[model samples]
Target: MLTRILPPPGPARMLIFITMVMSLGQGLWIAINAIYAVTVIRLTPGQLGVSLGITAALVLISSVPLGHLVDRAGPRTIQLWSFLSLAPLTGVLLFVQGFWSYLLVTSVQGLAYRAGNNARKAMIAARVPAGDRARIRAVIRAALNVALAVGACLAGLTLAWGERVGYQSAILLTALCFLVTGLLTLKEAPVPPVPAAAGAAFAVFRDVPFLLFTAVDGLLSTHGLLLDIVLPLWIIHHTDAPRWMSAVLLLINTAFVVAFQVRAARGTDELKSASWASLQGGGCVAAACLLFAMTGGAGLFMACVLLTVGALVHALGEIRHAAGSWTITYDLAPDHAQGQYQGAYKMGVDIGKMFAPALFAWLVIGHGATGWIVLAVSYAVLGAAVPAVVARGARSRATAKVAAGGVTSSTVRM
Candidate 1:
């Protein structure tokens, strides 16, 4: 169990260290974003909503093309830029005042980070062997979660120290961290080199099952973006929750990732089993969304408890989904086309972030939780159906190959 959870030494080890540094910076930013948006920027929930929506939108547009770039230029180029550019964009946040300016800076920051993140993940997936991919992915998730946990703890102290001082200091520290990691990534040699011809965007679309899974991945990504953007903003705006509650929420969400992500993602190599795992995780997150809707007017203490439990369940599902997706994605991707598949995967993840926050915000404000509830129900439905679809596709693919070779008459029996 320990060995499975711990990444083995070599490129994987270096990757984890670099990832941890990046996550530390990200964790600091995320841990504070809600509070900063509300308190410092004086942005309303709706503005915050739009800000995230724009960020997601940009990421969605960039992911596919950027993936192709990674294939063409190499992941090293993206990683270097992700690390180097973050410093100025994030540091400038301290100086920005109004809504438009803040949004611009933050969006730029998001785009830069998005490129770097997709490149890093693609590179990691490329380097690790097929059998160990789940464990490697899990290790990366756990490391990020651990970084989030650390940031949460520090954020609590930072807030107490002074809001402006705390936020500026945190951002600066985050920038420094990114710089170090970016330099480290530059130092390391490339483990996988994608073919130049594979640089064409949309190469992964040819695989029907892979494409289908990416659709589900898009939905899942939307829910994740909404949760990250909406929940805290809603709490701060609607309820009189203590500011420290943000740290509590962050801690709850990341704790499960640190503890159980790898374990839940185990045995995702079997396509059918992996699909089931995605459903299970998605169901858990959808249920949590419902629980949040039902619990109205709860004070900070009760909200904290409910959100923590919900977050734990959601994290379990996230781990399973991530593990299974990574496993299946690696299995389906042609060896030469790994970068393209990874880019497509990133595109799917960004698609949700693109529109979900703004839509969820509009629904909640224009309609009510009814809108949120409708979305939640849709999430549950997809959670249930997605696995069956993926499984069927996997089975069909397997059987068609056997039939082409005249090995088996029935798809399932084969």
Candidate 2:
């Protein structure tokens, strides 16, 4: 019965598959970037943090503009360009000597990364059937996480060799992976027609529900960014862990995501008022971050184990949030405005990625552990608050309109 009802694996599935493979390369590249910046480029931790923050900020600035370009040009072009550009940039990293050179190379890499992400998601939305979009997204996320786990292991092996050789090999491998993936994407169909203008493309600002969703999503992204930067650094620098512990810690997080994400999103087949679930997820992440802060003297293995448990809870929240958010976007977006809406959605995501590092860096420097706890608490409060307010407001506004309209009861549009 389930088999009969499920959509055939065709264009949408193929796109997801291809993109997932490409994303594996992206995952591998990002997982070890901090090590490379510190060991190979000879940058201080503070400088590396700032550099990463700046790159992310640039991506944030470029996301909407790139989205508009995708709408005007085509996702295929943008995706292809992004991949090809990454290949050369990774190769050029070998020659980067000074701080100025490092900054220039990283800035370009940021542009490619942002453009690739925007083009990829927009293509999936355009190409995939509406009904199965959420499931497809979940599957892609799970696959991407699994790939990242494998990539992190590989990166560890390379680093075990020596910093310079290891970093060069990883970067080159990533470049090749991008080259191949980008080329395959050339076979993709052109962008589909969107439904309507729905006002200006940027008019997503006027929609209150979307604004709230974007804000929550952006804030949630800080947790994810920390996983990349802070967690591993802590294991390496602060704890009495083996050098390989960073890779092991990542595997735990990715393994949980790969294993449990589907189950986490079991019944969320349609978009509805899910602000409660969103808050729950956010709260879990904030709590995990605080737990992460509390650990002091355990061995690397035990510390990683605790972190893994926290990450599992966090991953569950992440899956639900991803599924719910996409479902909402599909439900709320007017047809012709899908591209614009997607652009708007991505803009919110980028904002989170952009600010997380810079904001957290300052906190870590100024307040130390206390600062970390304060930031965690603040995020937790915001996480729990936004969804509750938005969900309740949606319900009240809906109820009031129904009451004003004479005797009949009616359901609100999700």
User: Model 2 over residues 279-298: C-alpha lDDT tens digits?
Assistant: 66677777776666654456
Report model 1's TM-score to 2 decimal places: 0.77
In model 2, which range of ten residues has the least summed lDDT?
405-414
C-alpha RMSD values across all candidates: 5.1, 5.4
Candidate that scores best on lDDT:
1
Q: Give each model's whole-structure lDDT.
A: 0.71, 0.68
Our tally of clashes for model 2 stands at: 4
Error of 1 at 398 (Å): 7.1
Task: For candidate 2, report its TM-score.
Answer: 0.77
lDDT of 1: 0.71
- Tens-digit lDDT track for model 1 on 1-414? 334567657888888888888888787788788788888878988998888777777767776676667666677777888779888887788888878998898888877787787678677766766667778788888887777667767776787786587788987888888888888987677655566543335656667777887877678757665457767766665544665665566566666677787787777766666667777767877777766664346777776676667666666667777776776666655555566677787777666665677888876545545765776787778778777767656675666556556443221221
Note the clash tally of each candidate: 1, 4
Candidate 1 Cα outliers beyond 4 Å, as residue runs: 1-4, 33-55, 92-107, 163-166, 198-201, 205-208, 225-250, 286-311, 358-377, 391-414
Spell out the clash pairs found in candidate 2: 194-336, 195-335, 195-336, 196-336
